[model samples]
Target: MGFRAMVCHRFSKLVLLSAAFISLVVNAAPWPDGAKIAVTLTFDLDAETIWWNDADTMTGNPGSLSYGTYGPKVAVPKILALLEKHDVRATFFIPSWVAEQYPDAVRSIAAAGHEIGAHGVRHVSPLQLTPEQEAATFSESVRVLDRIAGKRPVGYRAPSWAVSNATLKLAARAGFLYSSNMMDADDPYIHNDPPGLVELPVSWVLDDAPYFWFDEDSWNKTIHSAASVKAIWQEEFEAAYHGSGYLNLTMHPQIIGRPARLLMLDEFIGWMKRHEGVWLTTGSAVAVYVRGQQGRSP
Candidate 1:
């Protein structure tokens, strides 16, 4: 080959390599403040509302319903203490009924400087409600949360992760800054349809219900050991740490606050802290950061 032709080919290769590097720099480092990974430990504090709203309920039996009461009665304080020990601020999405029924629990969560987002009115899915009912429930959630927490919640995660087509638009109309129901992406993105509402995606893999939720009435007897769940979550966290740099772990106070499971969660948080460049924050903070990054109002 002629020297000039060979030189031209080498120049083109160099340009392509430079472009690839620039793309990596822009796309790979999405987390803020040079953090390698962003983590939000979110809890859906459904409490007794789930028992009453879900069809799987054994609500006829007081013993069956006591399981839900265990959440706010015993689990929440323990969960709060655990989070306090780690000095990690997390998010709790509570149904309005839970907040009202256990105002003190909600107050304690807020006093600890955690974010409280809307779950629904009575843990009912938006899909189960008509548009008017959904709107009313959403508004009631905002009202109760604001009343109890002393701050209006800016985030929403639909009960049971059952979001309808109107849920996002309704949340947007109600002035929510973000929704955490969708599982489409690993990273947060602004919804084009709502035109500025941020979506912090979630998945069942990262949620505790599939692994730990046991409902006798529903005949769901599967409950893995805490060690197994910890290993699964650790693997998932590592992958997120290396890939998209975002990990949102969803849990319930009743399920994860059990002694062994809570111990596992404490150990997991410690393990995560051992890694450098990890930001453990709340859902609201994540939404604000991602929105600010994308040139939108937080």
Candidate 2:
């Protein structure tokens, strides 16, 4: 075996298989203009402070607090006119006491441009507070959603996503750039134990509050059928549009703003608007495009 030491071991195995296929095509096209799949239609709105955050799952029964005041007094203007008839730019989070008891429906979901974030000031569950009461509930939920949603909420969605092993270092010291209360991963990750922060992950089977929540003290949840939860969210957005992964849909505005579950979320947003590299964004524009594709900054 001496043809110049077998051509220098086949040129170091072709430079380690061309650096592992250019790191698998740069982590399989991490979406932007050349998108492949990154949809986020989030919403937490948790009105009536999600039933007073816990008195053993409080059911003080004013018809269970008017079922959380039918989410901003009648389902957030029918989920903001079905996301302004699908012009789409979704992401709502809120719980600064449901934005101080519906500050004009959270200022009309931030004047319909959407993207509010921070969901805690009464929806509780920083696993029962006390890291100085969850850092004074994230500084009074960023000073009450920046004095009633006048902008100042990068992101943070815990209250019931229940994080407390120092909830991502107190949401990166109360200045979150991302943290959709974690589920682990479908993509988006950058948290070297509180290094620059960015997580954008969530799931409970693409969450519609465990198949459309209803309660008279949790009547063993059955009401499902918005055409079977939009056929399980169009099969998890066609398996994240064939693996470019990231779906992140968690809804509630008193349970999918019921009108047959908002027309099954307007026919599942016209089946994800006949997909084609889908990047229907907003969880802070997918956490600022995953922190500008991991170069990282805010």
Candidate 3:
């Protein structure tokens, strides 16, 4: 063959080899066995603010109160009942104030064999606070959660999904083992931050808060209809079932506790139970499993 043709052939071979290697690297990561799907049901209990405070008498409707209409009184019992009925455990992310005010409720969750983690001290977003302020808030939250649960919280979900670099550092400094702040990926992976906390990326698409709080107009129009929401959930579940990826479903007691909303939740749970090989567990359990796998790998 001519020299020019030989050079072109070698370049083509190199390109093909590089592409094959890249593909292998992308698909080489092993997913967890047994359907490779872990369904984490996380509830954010944040009802301590003025709009949600039982003592607060705010007649006019506020943005925060828009979602706060569903409080502990309406949410806790239903959630407990659902968990018990389904024989499933969940992670309840409670604000420090809620833990203090509803000790009985918190105790009930712990007694039910579920995991309890810190949501925040008050329901304030982490982005709103300066680094120093955020650190102080995080420290107090950890102390309060530990006091309430009788153990240091191993996980955290930033209030409003509001996270920053400083917020992540604060979480690690506070000794959290995992944080569900980043939405970069669907799988649970470790972030090499200072405290080296694991990042269990919770999908905003899987959460009900954004629909209710952020898109009030659209949510109001579709709040009664569970078809769209359920379809997306089922699709994600099926994809994860096939791909062996993690499926995390997030909800709030106040939002999903209403009679109509509860029906939607029930339907979704029913659908989930019909499937085989799905691992329904708490966020902490999934994190622990992933960490264990990492430890065993060479």
Candidate 4:
């Protein structure tokens, strides 16, 4: 072959080989074949109304009254029934205040094979607390949840999605395996604080509470009906279903317990059942899976 033709041929062959190698590496990843995505359902069981503390009392903060009005009476039961009906497991991020009020509910959740996680002592924003206060909150929350569930909570999720570096450090120091407080990535990642904690990043866009509270009218307009929410969830699931990526779905029992919104959750669970090869699990399970993969890797 002529010199120019030979050079071009070699370059094309190299490009083709590189493409094949890239394809092989991606295809050989640990996720099961035809399984592109896994989802972990995490509920923030704030249970605000159950507390007698001034800051958490129903009369003190009517907007935060999840426990007294809806949680114990309607939401928790509905959520449990829905999960049981679908045969799916989930994680409940319980504040120390809530665990103290509803020890029976915490035990029931543990018995039902779901994961329990710490969600601070009160539903106060982490950014508002000093480092010492944050550490105490973490310690107390862990202690309370462990007492109720008979197992130490391995994961933490900040109340109101408000977190700080200090909060993360405290969580790590408290012996948590993971925190869902960081929104830096779409995938699960190991965060290296001085004490080291993995951050299974959760998407706020994927959560339902913000949608309902901040943009209630817009949310109603967008989701329109139950089918709309179901369609959006399915689309997101399909997009995430091709890699060993993590999907975190966040919900508040009170917010999603309404008859209309519950229907949407039911539909989404139905769709999840129709699909095969997806690992529907709790946040702790996802954290464990990621930790296992880290251990296996060089």
TM-score of each: 0.87, 0.34, 0.80, 0.81
lDDT by residue (1-298, candidate 1, tens digit) is 1111000110111111132333111222245667788899999998777666454452545676777888999999999999999999999999988899899999999999999999998787789889998999888989989999999999999999899979999999999999998887776666766777888889999999998988677775788999999999999999988776778888999889899999999999999999998999999998887666553212
* Local accuracy of candidate 2 as per-residue lDDT tens digits, 1-298: 1111000010111111132333111232246676667789988988776665364464455766777789888988888888888888899898787788679988988898888889888787888878888888888988999999898998898987999988889889887888888775566665655766778778899888888776557588777788988988899888777763678898988888878888889889877888876778698887776655543211
RMSD of each: 8.8, 17.4, 8.9, 9.2
Better of 2 and 3 by lDDT: 2
Model 3 lDDT-worst window of ten: 1-10
**Candidate 1 positional error at 205, Å:** 0.9
Candidate number of the best lDDT: 1
C-alpha lDDT of all candidate models, in order: 0.82, 0.75, 0.70, 0.70
lDDT of 2 at 150: 92
> Whose TM-score is greatest here?
1
Ranking by lDDT: 1, 2, 4, 3
- The parts of candidate 1 lying over 4 Å away from their true place are 1-29, 53-59, 218-220, 295-298
Evaluate residue 22 in candidate 2 and report its C-alpha lDDT on the 0 to 100 scale: 32
Q: Write the per-residue lDDT of candidate 3 for residues 59-154, one digit (tens) a residue.
A: 435665655545676788888898898899999888887788778788888889889988877777777778998888788888887787776788
